[model samples]
Target chain A: MEKRVTFRGWMLPLLLILPQVVISAVFFFYPAGQAIWQSLFIQDPFGLSARFVGIDNFTFLLSDPFYRASFVTTAVFSVLVTLCSMVPALFLAVLADRLIKGSGVYRTLLIWPYAVAPAVAGVLWLFMFNTRVGIISWYLGTLGYDWNYVLNGGEAMGLVVVASSWGRISYNFLFFFAALQAVPRSVIEAAAIDGARFWRRFFTIVLPLLSPTTFFLLVVNVVYAFFETFGVIHTITAGGPQQSTTILVYKVYADGFVGQDLGSSSAQSVILLLVVGLLTVIQFKFIEKRVHY
Target chain B: MRKSLIGALLASATVLSPLAAYAETEVQFWHAFTGRLGELVKAQVEEFNNSQSDYVVVESHKGNYSETLNAGIAGFRAREQPHILMVFEVGTATMMSAKGATKPVYEVMAESGATFDPNAYIGSVKGYYTSTDGEMLSLPFNSSTPVLWVNRDAFEAAGVDPDTDLSTWQKVGETLTALKAGGEECPLVTAWQSWIHLENFSAYHDVPFASKHNGFAGLDTELMLNGEAQVKHLSAMGEWARDGKFIYTGRRNEGGANFRSGECALFTESSAGYAGIKAEAEFDFDVRPLPYWDGVGNAPQNTIIGGASLWVLEGHDAEEYKGVGEFLAYLSSSDVQAKWHQDTGYLPITAEAGEATRAAGFYDENPGTDIAVIQMTAKEPTANSKGLRLGSFDQIRGIIDEELEAIWAGDKSAQEAMDSAKERGDTLLRRFETANN
Candidate 1:
């Protein structure tokens, strides 16, 4: 009994956090700290011409129109993509929960897009939206839409949002579906017996119960929308038919590696990190409170 | 008696053995070339390794042009930098500012006492890689200029003249309209938006892409993409985008597949596209000189370079540097240069190789091969015609692409897009200036 207690006391923390700590130090802290350090001065490959620029990079970034637009775009993209993904995902999750036959097949099919890598997804989407031979182009042409995302701002944004949501839907759906499955079937049955209709039971019982999963997914989807979609943006529009699709991370890439403006890139990165960080905190503080769990 | 016999045998073996004198020096080469180009590079390395015994050269495909540059930067931060790296033309200013990060090619050759002659290279190619003082910094390899790729079958399918004179933007615009009118949806598509459209477009019109020798002069230079001529041209493209005549694919030769599939009649792509076009294109296609804005100037001036070049990285032993020098010499050899130029449709770096190619009747046999050279060397490059030297040009190009896309989408006019791009790009320039300073 003593041995077991001692093992639980001493080894539990290590078992729980040893991997986390190691990964954090290796991958997260190291790069983040290095970026911060590098951000303090300018780096030229000839040898570093580092002057202690201090907060000059940040100040410069604030004044830059490109950086500002990127921030705006990232915010807009994150919110729009998250909303677009979540609404459809929740609907599908709820619909699947109510199904009796072939529900598994439907679920599997819906979840299929999650298996694709972002790079592959980008390529697939690009092909589907290709002006020359795209499947969507054919359908859109039939529907009387010109289907020219390259020539329409609204269409460009719509395509990006849709392409982004296609992969994200499955991810959100899985979470919501799992949460839905976990809801007490007895409680739902009781509510149904008490004369609660489909909408009433869903609103009063199912949705409230699945709030935790929705909240968690919302945060994750927002981050994904902001950071991971750069590949899609780069591969699809390259932030064009003009800067319509250029978001924060792509801007960071352009400034640092493409522009060789490491200071400015770092500045952009710092802003992105802060924005994401703040959003994460707000999710925890506000939305998480309302979650059932 | 057994121990005495073993001792005698050991003693005899020791006396007969020769001492090993030296170890091999290793050099790391990071390049962007993949597939065929990658194989060619490896073959060259293998040949060099076989020719000598003292040094070993390791070549790694870092990534494509931008990715390779990113990898080089990341590697430097990690202190795992290769001894040699391939940087695209736009990265010239970035490399130049990395003072201690690089050992200039001229100095390396001088230090190694190799038979290096800068004059052997063509003037235009060398001029781009040279320092302000005319001292070469990097060796130009795989240099190319944008050219027009014509799908004759597509043209004929549309019932348009296959030999249509597409010398000016006005003519190409008219041809595109005709092609679309004749039921050709994807008539014209382009690769490298900022490269062919803004950079080469500026040079071809004898106008400046950026100020101060395209930013080679100082970091204070701003983008000139918002100029009157640039605005006019962009608006024209925007109009085509609306009419479904021009399609904008993702950056980095996304239209290569479209062109290769023989769906697009006219493509503005790097001359290096020739190698792939020749290999994959089943239909009859032809290379032509890049079209210009006939109204912009009296006539077309010249095209600027694309592709990439080899830059020597610092942090290597003298023996390794010696091997690098020798390998570079081999790569620049007349036979090697001529072959690479002919095979890849990249420019011949050396005058001798260009002359040899001409003498060999390669250009005569293959029409339009000399178009890039003729276009680039049409006249002595003025400050305006000289290549852009802006630091972080890749980022700026992205901005230009974004703004240009806006124009195409009709969200903003060309004038508005360029204005925004300039405003956005100048902020980066100022930041680059302050940081570099």
Candidate 2:
């Protein structure tokens, strides 16, 4: 029999969720609504007055080749960051789970990067890969690689992806490590007794069991790559080397703040909001079906 | 009884404090300066505050240039704008077009009965922040122009004459080739790539960077940067880049680090790099006027300014305006301006300030320090030489940077890059025109 607690009244339950509702309303819904409303109008920088232009801003953005290019860039960046951050994290977490000695030290060392700010991570990688003075760049030059991210679009994109993913690995590692530890010992022991090789046992049992955690991380990492990598891009590249790394969020910031184009920026934001919403729905509808739990 | 006595004392203190505060009008000044520059601004504010009892000028450091401009705009939206806001040269057009948002400096001076003369300022510096009628719109403060910064030690090590004249681009190119042949790693690097390389390069060559008098005459101007001279100069630079004679550092003075570290033989950067180079460089260095292409038409016209100016935001109280006026006058005084110019390496906006600095033998003491000022004041500015006043210029600069990077990377020809830059930048200009006009 299933058991559940019943609230004394709807009032109590509503009161219990009031703070969250108010927070979402004020912080998320209101600003999002305002952006949508502002997307339909053009205003001067001073905010003295505005003129409504219906869907003109949207039409202009849709017709802009640069804006369309940013969408493709954002897609590529998101996929690369998610894979780079998650694959290394999963590998490290598995190694950490198997460790019997000094595991605490190794885990602590692995988790240390999570504390670094994204911008700081970007600067750290930039110092290592800087064209003039970077040690890595100098080493690469000696190897005849000639690393110059400032002029090379591919190198710039790769640098930002690595820097952004470097900080996220620790977060993903924590979750994967915890999930790996939670796997039932008896199941693995039974598999070992059945003469199954370690790799086969892990693939058949532990991997399938970890699907739920992996799915959760996938959604989270995608959102992070989309929204939270702005600092890394701003510091490392400023979306440069020929706009090759100008992701959607960075373009929104560059257009709105630097260009001071409120209408176009707002329209871009509205489009981003819709893209995120559709992505979230698709994730739940398609990707979540693969999760074991 | 103790609580009641404390409450009574607090009430009396509050009543007396208001009366004391009411005696002086407070003026808020927001600036985008940090580090040594920040300290100098603080000192200036302290001097102004100490000079008067009726008005107190409170100064705040508000991030870098772009961030500070955004802050001022956001504050204005919230109706909490500062009395005086420091806006960089790129923001001049946006500030000028925001009707009823700012009080013209000339009007502020006249209304406050402060002794004012627009002619007291240097024409090149003042023209950047003036109206079409030659009225001063903003107070020119901390103006800087781009110049050639050479590391003498690097040149000497490269077997090139340390005192070789880099007056023309041909000479600069030969020197760069010599430096590269002598095993120098970085022959030339630049800061503010578009500002120094393209915009000022155009002005110094008496060529228009944009149509309609570089956008000063009207709002419907388009980018005119893809001219034959510009293409020629950029193609040469691109070839030099391919030969490893020119190093492409990250945009916006990331090259300054390499230059100041004595790794680069020649650096084209702002004159304001003086303060940083002075503090950081271990080798001998000197400033020279920006090099121009000899083949360009009547080359080496006056270079334009790049630093920031002070605009008076509207909606402040009358007394606050008076305090702001008095503070501007104090800031523009010859003693203050000369000291600021000498200490910060920014141009003396006023002619008297330049004279005072010269009389004090500052220019004699610091050789090449006057190159920026002399380069700027060499000739009365032509229509093409006066600073650009286009809307969405900052964004256009970003576009230009991207295109220039493509050129340096050998991914696109100079002609193709500049043509694309003009087309893309013109769209933003049209958007700006539709929005503002």
Candidate 3:
């Protein structure tokens, strides 16, 4: 039998859902509609006048080699951030789950990084890895290694990726820890009594049980890396060293705010919106099937 | 009834006080100066405010250059723009392209009956902000030119003579090689790499950085930065980077710290760096005219300005425009300009100010302080050296910076990088043309 909460009338249901519908319309639909409208016109910075360009912005963006290059950059960056953040978070969550004492202390300490803003986190990393005066780079220099991220695109990417993922690990850790605790201890003990080793039990029983949380985190972290890591990239590198770290969202910000090319930026944002929508749909359609609950 | 009457009386009093004090017109000025420079601007505002009672100029710091420009644009959209907006040199084209949004300073000065003289300003500094028809569009402020700064202590320590002539890139290179052999960790470092190296290099070598007379002739212009002189200069710098004779610190002023901390032996930076270098640097230093390539003909031409200017926006009242005119007149006055020039390391925008400072022996008190003004006014700037007026220059500089970084990393040759920058930058120019035209 299916369980449902039934309303007395359609009016009641509509009234109950009215707040969310109003919010989505105002915040999401309104701006999205405006962006689509604005993307069709080119205007000066002052917006006193506008010319109807009619898809020229989109056509230009699609044909530009730099915009296409940023797509691959965004993919690589998001994947790296998600993996680097989640894998360590899962390991720490598992270790904390096995702890008998001081788990609260460890958990509280692990949550500290999540409180730091991305821009501040970026500054912290930038200071330590500064090519000229940074302590870490200086130490590396003393160790007979010349560490110059200012010129080296590979090193610049590595530093930003690490900085972007650092704060995210705590966020992932919090959710994973809660899920690990909610996993029934009796089932794990039963498996242990059946002569399954720690690793074997974790792989066969605990892993499958945590799949729902993992899937949710996968989607959340991918979105986080795509949109929210902009502060890290902007503060660390202003998308330089040959545009190696110029992700799609950063391009939107640079063009819209810095470059003041609003038409192109709005078009880029519209494309980014569609890409995110498609990704979410794909995740729900294919990846959600593997979720245990 | 008594309480309501008291509330109504208090509201009336609040409204009446503003009416009494509202006799003075307030002129809002937004700028992008901070630190020592910010303090000077505040002092200037307070002085102007104290000088007269007709207009009260309220100045606000609105973040850095790009942020302030964006804020001004956003304000215009919201119909709340300041009376005046200070834009950096590169933002010249963007401001010019916004045809109806800005009210030219010449029109303001003329309509308000304020004392105005276009010839008062230094030619090169004025040329950058002037329209094609020879009208002053903005009030030039805090203009600076790049110059070579030598750490004399480092030079003496390296057994190289501190007084060696570094008028040419060949000599600078030789000096850098010696500084490197002296075990100097940072032989040479630069701030604003594209401005100091490429843009100034082209102008100083008397080569066209862009066609259409550096965008002064028409809106349709293409970059000529990949020409022979620019590439040869960059190639030399690339070789120096590869040999570890030069350090690539950053795109902006991150190299400033390196230079100020006495880690760098030679710095190519704006003359405005003097104020900071004066206070922070413990060792002896000297400023020299920017070096030019020896191979280029008629080299060592005048370099371009790198600082900002104040532009008046439209939609302001005539009373406010009159105040704007007076405030600008006060700012460009000889005494005020000379004092500003003496206090900070910026070039005096007016010839009278430059003369007043010299007459006051400020330049004598500080040796090498006049090099920037001398370098900039060395000759009548030819078409090549009058400074760039390219549209979408802020983004184009990003492309130039990326390509320059590639050369520093040895990922691409100077020729390849400059060619790539030209191609990328031209696309932005075309877009800017389409939007503006």
Candidate 4:
């Protein structure tokens, strides 16, 4: 009788959550479900008649080399960009903790690029990498490296990684800094008293305490690397110099918006959704429990 | 003298005039033109608004061609679409096939009883915008063909003759080598890779950009970009890229900055690049016909257009429709078209407007603005020379951009790149076919 009353007590809260759940269903689940439905059917620009073809779209995409290559490119790009951005961001956050003065100023300066719009960021980087009049290109040329992202695939990828990481550092740093701030001062002092040197304290105590934020940011950074960096690539490289940077999101945009192939583009989107969704679930399941807090 | 009566009449007339001016319906126009061209379009709208009382034209910049197209789509979905949309050449089929969604320009003109003659438009410019039965669908606003922009100052600095016959790609390649070898870094570059390289390449050689009347006749068109000649040209371009003779920029007018900055000696860019070039270039520059590949069959047949045209969207009230008609009529007027052509370096939509521009001697004074018109209308466009009409062409261009980039970066050979582009592009083609058929 006590257990039944406890279950009944919580019933109203779940009922109140119904509207929010329905709204999420409509906005999120419906579009995702519709995308999957559309992927299985062929569609014209007119949104006219569609014929359902069972698994044909998936089969066709799997056989296509371009789609396969884009998947690989996206994976490689996401991993590299995440690793580059997250590691440096943590380092900066830890360093910021050690600052005796002007830490607030340093924090403010680090978060500046986060305010720039994605398209504007792309245009800025595009101008900087421009071969003719770009300041970066001019300086590089003076040092004799040519610095043409258009001609060199490796350099194009490198530039993309740099531009993507530069903007991403702000986001990661914000989260890591907040986490670092919340770490108890007494625990850190205790570790120091125990003769845990600076590096040792950071690796064992501070890093373990920051694990929750790190894991959270890792998932977010992965998602960002997959989706957000496409804009930079779209603006900077456009998967060029021999398609060195044709990631999944870029391909989806190219296929859907530019090609106007709604069916195939939809198919590509759904495939991307599945891949990203699986990766996200795996990340949460494996990493979320490692957080002590 | 009836002074009291005269004073009362004058006071009443002043109030009436202001109301009459504000009574005109407002028509909204969304377009992709900006910079010098944006100013020119704004001027045209202001002039039209000033000259008219029935409708006031309000023009808004909706980003570049692709962004504008996307914005229109989103707006239409939200039922907030503008009356007129400036869609690029490749988006023609997408807009055309959107049934019950667009108001054909012919119907709009007829409804307004405006004097519109389809025959007045240049054949090459008008053909792409017309239907199978020859009905005008959209009003061609800014029509331009690809041409080679030679920075004569850069040429002089590099000690190469600016006017020496740059008629063939082989010659341009040699000249580019000479310039680069003489210490010029950005010797040659181009904008709109797919349009200039693949689309115009096919047209120049009197070959097809696609099959089945370039998809105008049907939806089952397959890409022919993987053909032998195209591969050969791409391979050569790849070689130039490796040798640092040709500077590869991002697709979609990335090299425009290079050409305008006078960093590159020769640039293959849309003729419409003229407005920006004229405005910004600190060096002497001239537009010439796009160079041909000597090995390709019948090189330099003609170049394809790379500008946008105004299309009327459906689902507006009668008053809005009238406003759209009046605004389109205002845009098509000889004076308006002529001024637009002169100001923006876009071709005049009508022959009379072209003649009006020439009579004013603008082309003669400008030196190379007329080259686009002359090259495009040099002869009647063969079926191959007529513009491509494939659905989802924008996406295909993206795929082409990807493959071409690969070829340029030396990761994929030209033949391999072309093959991948064709195969990838065809998957889209088949899907478009299955859907549209």
Candidate 5:
């Protein structure tokens, strides 16, 4: 049966949704439309003059090797960030779920990192891992291990991934903790009574029940790693050490703001928008099928 | 009726007050200075405001150089730009090509009927912000050039002569080898790697960094920095890096921290690095001319300026223009320019200001401070060594930085990195040409 709330006057329904429609149109549609429009033109840095060159920016970006390399960098970065953030968050959630007292204190302590801004978090990590004056770097040096991320591509990528994932673990932990608490005690007890071990019980009953949460988090974490790690990469590496860490979003900022190549930046943004859209569609289409609820 | 009568009386009294006699026109001046520089700029503004009764100049710090330029552009797009914008030297070409967006300083001075003389400015400094006919387009402010900053105590500790001659690259190399042999961890480090090591390297060697008179003659310039001279110099630096004689710090000025802490024996940085070094370093240091390769023809021609200048944005009212012109004239005055040079270690843009500083014995009191001025004004700038005026220069600099980093990391040879950088940078240049031309 289909149930609907009907408004007698058409004006009331229109008025009820006017704010959301206006917000979406103004903030989302308008700027996206502008990017699409601007991507078709090449303009001076100051916008004093603009020439219409339809499809040229997109074609140029597609043919550029650096832009293509950024795609691979983004992929590796997103996968690493998702795994690093979610695995520790799940372990912490499981540990907190087993606690009987002071769980609130543990949860509060774990949730504090999310309060720090991404750029600030990156700076904190950078200070600790700085090649010249960092305490950690000094310690590593004493251990006969030279740690200089400024020139090392692999180390630079690792530093950014660790910094980015460190900030995101708190958000993932909160959701995972909530989902774990909601798992029924009786189901676990019944499995225990049937002589199943703790690990077996968890794998059979609790883990299956948490599949829906896991799937949701996977999608959310992928998106978070994709769109929100720009500040981390910017403050830490700045897409250097031979462009090893120049992700898609960071490239947009470096090209648009730093380079002042607006057309290429807009084209890059359009491509990133399509990429996120496509990923979301794929996640909903295939990955959600295996989710329990 | 009583209340209305009271209101009318109050309005009349407000209009008749003595404080309302002169309505001072406000001139908005946005700059990119912070810390010590910021305080000095504020003092200058306060002096100007106190010296006048008809104009109030409101100065604001608008982030760092690139951020300030972006903010100015965004403000212009919103029709809320300040009357005066301080742009870094790299943004000269962008500002020049922004045709209707800015009113040239020469036009502003003439239209406001202010006493103006273009020849008062030092030629090499003014050449950066001028037209082909030698007309001043922007007022050069806070100009600086690259120089070698040597830690004398470090050199002495390393058993190298503190007064060793380092005018040529070969001499510097020998000094670095000696410093390394004497247990110095970092013999040499550089800031603005691409700027000091390549761009200025080309200019100082009197080689073309880019074609078309380094982009001054036309918009069709492409990078020519991968030539034999540049390759030889960069290869030497690369070899130094492999032997731990040269430290590879982060791209911009991060090496300053090491140098100031006395970890590095020599630093190639801006002449303006004096202020920071003086404030931070506990050891004796000296400023010297940037080293050149003896093999290159007539090496050490001149190193170009790297600081910023003041550009007058268009669409301002006539009265504001008058205030801007007056402020610029006041800023270019000999006393103010001399004090700025003495306090900040920037080159005095005006020849008169330089003379005044010399007369006051500022250079003699602060030994080695005059090296930058002498390096710039020693020879008339040639077409190859004047300065680069290419569009999309900031982006090209980034490409060059990446390539240089690759070379430093031993990922690529100097020739390979430079070739790649030139190819990548040329694409941006071509795009800039198409967009602007």
Candidate 6:
């Protein structure tokens, strides 16, 4: 039996959701519609003149090898950022969960990186890894290993991925730690009495209970890696060393704002929108089935 | 005739002071200068304001060059553009293509009845921001050209001559070898590699960087940067990069820090590198002319300029434009121009300003301060040596940077890289042609 709070009239429900609908329309839907419309035209930097090219921008983008390469780069960056951020975060969360002494302090310390902006995190990593003047690269030079990401494509990609994931790990740690605390104590206690080891009981019982949080984080972090890591990529590599580190969002900024190619940039964003939407749909359709919640 | 009339009104209005002038026209100026340069620009605006009671010029420091141009365009779209916007050299083509967005400087000067002499400008710098018929479209505010920056301390430390004659690329290669063998980590590092290496390289060697008189002749121009001269030079640089003589730095001026810190022996950077090197270098430094290939006929052609210029935007009234014209006259005055050129290492745009700076002994006091000016005016510019006027050049430069990086990384040969760059750049040029046409 469930208690239902049915709306007495349609007006109240509409009024309750009005603010949300308005915000989404203004911030999300309107801009998305504008991007789609703008994609069909070519214009100078000034909007005084515009030509209706009608899908030429999209055709150009799809035909560009560099643009196609960026799709692969974005996918690789998203996966690397997700795995690198999540594993260490889960480990830290599990370690903090076991702490009986000063657990709050440990948890607070673990969550501090989330407060840092993505660009700042990138600069910090850049300072340590800069080829000529960086402390870490200087030490590596003393050991006789050449470290110049400015020329090496693989090194540039590796550096941007690490820099992008640095702040995201702190965010995932917060969610994972909160979920770890909410696990039922009775279940762990009962498992301990069944001659099961701590590792086995934790994996089989506690980890299964944290599925909903994990699934949610997976969705959020994948979206974050796709869109929100532009700052880190820009500050660290600027999609350079032969465009090896050029993620999709960074290309959007580079083409649209920096290059002033608005039509092609809008076409790129529409493609990115479809990509993320399809990724979300796939995740919800398949991955959600495995989640107990 | 109209220009002279506005010039007369400006003089009479000033002479009459508060009685004759009913209103002080407000003129807005947007620029992309910051730090010491930003303060200097603010001071110039203040001086202009203080010098006149008939007009007031308000100067705002927009973000960087790209941001300032975008802001001007966005403002134009909103019908709120500044009276004048400072645009970088790469954006000249885009500015020219958008016919209604700008008010040509010659027209502004003519219509406002302001006193302006087009012949007063240096040919190379003036040629960059002009129409095909030699109509000045923008005022050349702060022009700079590429020069070889040498860190004397690093050179001496590597057992090389601090005053080596680096007149030709052949000589530079010999010095680079000596510096590397003497245990220099960075024998040669450059800022704005594409500018110093390829674009200016083509100009200095009197080779076309693009077809159609380097795109000044027509919109159908294709990149000629993949020609024999350019490929040969890039190949030599690529060989140096392979031998650890030419250390590749980050794309922009990130190498400025390495050079300033005495980590690099030889730096190929803008002559305006003077501003930073003067303030920051703990080691002694010197400026030299950009090197050229030894074999080309009349090889050491002038290098092209690489700084921002002032272009008046549309949507401003005639009264405000008179203020703009008056302000431009004040800015290009000998006193102000000499001071700006002496302070920032930018070339004095006006010939009178250069002569005044020389007459005032500023050049003698500052050893290498006049190098950029001399290098720019050293020869009457040929079709190949004048300047690039390609649309979508900013994006084209990005493609060039990418391909050059591949050459430096030993992933592609110089010929292959330049060919790819030309192919990629021509595509953008075609797109710009269709869009603008």
User: What CAPRI class is candidate 1?
Assistant: acceptable
Model 5 Cα lDDT, one tens digit per residue, B307-333: 999999988799989999999989988
TM-score of 5: 0.96
Q: Could you report the DockQ of all the candidates, in the order they appear?
A: 0.45, 0.79, 0.76, 0.47, 0.76, 0.68
Candidate with more favorable, higher DockQ: 2 or 4: 2
DockQ of candidate 4 compared with the true complex? 0.47
The TM-score of candidate 3 is 0.96
Residue A138 local lDDT, model 5: 93
For residues A89-163, write the lDDT of model 1, one tens digit per residue. 999999998899999999999999998887678789888988768998989899997787765656777788888
Candidate 6, TM-score vs. the true structure? 0.95
TM-score of each model, paired residue for residue: 0.88, 0.95, 0.96, 0.90, 0.96, 0.95
lDDT of 1 by residue, B1-437 (tens): 13343235433543443321136666668889889888888777777777777766777676688889887877675566777889999888888877877889998888877787889987778888999999989988888889999999888888999899998888999999999988897999999988988888888887777888789788899888888888888989989988889987755687999999987888999988888999999998988889878778534876778777788887767878887888787778888899888988899889989899999999989888888888888788777776878886777787777677677667888899888888878876776776677
TM-score of 1: 0.88
What does fnat come to for each candidate? 0.72, 0.79, 0.77, 0.70, 0.77, 0.77
| Candidate 6: docking tier | medium
Q: List the residue pairs that clash in candidate 2.
A: none
Q: What is the Cα-based lDDT of residue B348 in candidate 1?
A: 88
Task: Compute the TM-score of each model's chain A versus the native chain A and list the values.
Answer: 0.91, 0.98, 0.97, 0.91, 0.96, 0.97
User: Can you write out model 4's per-residue Cα lDDT over B1-437, one digit (the tens) per residue?
Assistant: 13343234433543453333546775768899777778888887877777767886667787889888877776665566678999999899888878677899999888877677778888888898999999999999888888889999988888888887898988988998889877888888889899999998888888877888788788888888888888888889999988989888777787888889888898998887887898899998888888888968777687778788999988777887887887787777889888888877788879999999999989779998998888888877888888999877887887888788878777889999888888878877777667666
lDDT per residue as tens, model 6, B1-437: 12344235444544554323346777878899999999999899888888879887767777888889888887776666779999999999999998988999999998878778877888898999989998999999998999999899988999999988998989999999999999998999899999988989888889899999999999899998988999999999999999999988878998899899989998999988899999999998888888888996468888898999999998778888998999987887778888998889888988988999899898788888888888889899999889988888888888999999999999999999999999999999998898888
DockQ of 3: 0.76
**Model 6 C-alpha lDDT per residue in residues A57-144, reported as the tens digit of each score:** 9999999999999999999999999999998999999989999999999978877888989999999999999997699999999999
Q: Indicate which candidate wins on DockQ.
A: 2
List clashing residue pairs in candidate 6: B2-B113, B3-B113, B3-B114, B7-B113
Write model 4 residue lDDT over A267-286, tens digit each, in one string: 88888888989999998888
- Which portions of model 6 show Cα errors greater than 4 Å? B1-23
Worst 10 contiguous positions by lDDT, candidate 5 chain B: B1-10
